[model samples]
Target: MNDETSGKASIRRELLASRALLTSRDVEDAAAALAASALELPELAGARTVAAYVSVGREPGTRALLDTLRARGVRVLLPVLLPDNDLDWAAYAGPEHLAPAGRGLREPDGPRLGPAAVLDADAVLLPGLAVDGRGMRLGRGGGSYDRVLARLAAAGRHPALVVLLYGNEVVARVPEEPHDHPVDAVVTPAGTRRFG
Candidate 1:
């Protein structure tokens, strides 16, 4: 494997290993802080709709950010894994519909919508194992987000792509494959920083 892919592999391993030592609450706290910082960005102001992930594995929580966005009248959409490994979406009207989904991820319930609907979001908060300054993202061996996001980008209808990570998760560079997608920004507990 090339340096980029190797770097991403190392980061993913580190994150997965670290998750064993972290409580759910700890991830939630860090996620809340990171999302708050992202929301503070001027480019993020007044967004009508946002798409967030149901962080599973070592990814951080987006619950706090969802609540805050709802308070501001911003609609939120969460991913639902489709039978074909494509991502479907649904509105997170409130916490009432949320339940634990596969892989220990909690997502909003309701009907599953198409990828086009998710692409309509003003911003998309991505769940990644690690991210590089170039906006390349490393996910949990699934290409769902990468494929969906890449399609959106190719169509020029993509929302701003932001990866949520712990501060330590940021690396000098990440491994890139022809199919990997690049995020627009990375948000950590420290703050939101633009990537590619």
Candidate 2:
């Protein structure tokens, strides 16, 4: 791997390790706080549709946020992992509509709306390990969300790209590559930080 790639890998490992240390109670509290903070963002408050994902393991939780958005009469789209690592989306009906998927992910059990469904969103809540001061995000290296960003760009869809993370996950820098896309903001347990 090149320097940038290796650097991202190292940072990702550190972030994941820190997350692994979080207790279930810690995760729960953070989830609630994150949702509250995220809900305050104008991007979400005015959004008619949001593309989001279900949190698994120790990743910053998004369940509360997703439910609240749905409750507000906003169209919430949840991703379904395709075999090739690209994401297909489905409407979020409720907790009972979720089913287990590969990689310990929970996906909406509704009809697959295809990958391009994300273009309908006014905002997208991304899952990430970290986002730098420059708004560049460090994902799990799966390239799924990368494709989502690319698809949005190709279609001229500029949804508000937001990441849900813990307070500590906002760092000074994140190793970036040419294909990497910067987010519009990050919503952490503490609050939201917007970027250009």
Candidate 1 structure, TM-score to reference: 0.88
Q: What C-alpha lDDT does candidate 1 achieve relative to the native structure?
A: 0.78
lDDT of 2 by residue, 1-196 (tens): 9999999999999999999999999999999999999999999999999999999999999999899999999999999999999999999999999999999999999999999999999999999999999999999999999999999999999999999999999999999999999999998888888998
Positional deviation of residue 67's Cα in model 2 after best superposition, in angstroms: 0.8
All candidates: TM-score: 0.88, 0.99
Winning candidate number (lDDT)? 2
How accurate locally, in lDDT, is each candidate? 0.78, 0.95
Writing each residue's lDDT as its tens digit, candidate 1 over 87-115 gives 88898877778888776668777877777
Q: How many clashes does the backbone of model 2 have?
A: 0
Query: In model 1, how large is the Cα lDDT of residue 110?
Result: 83
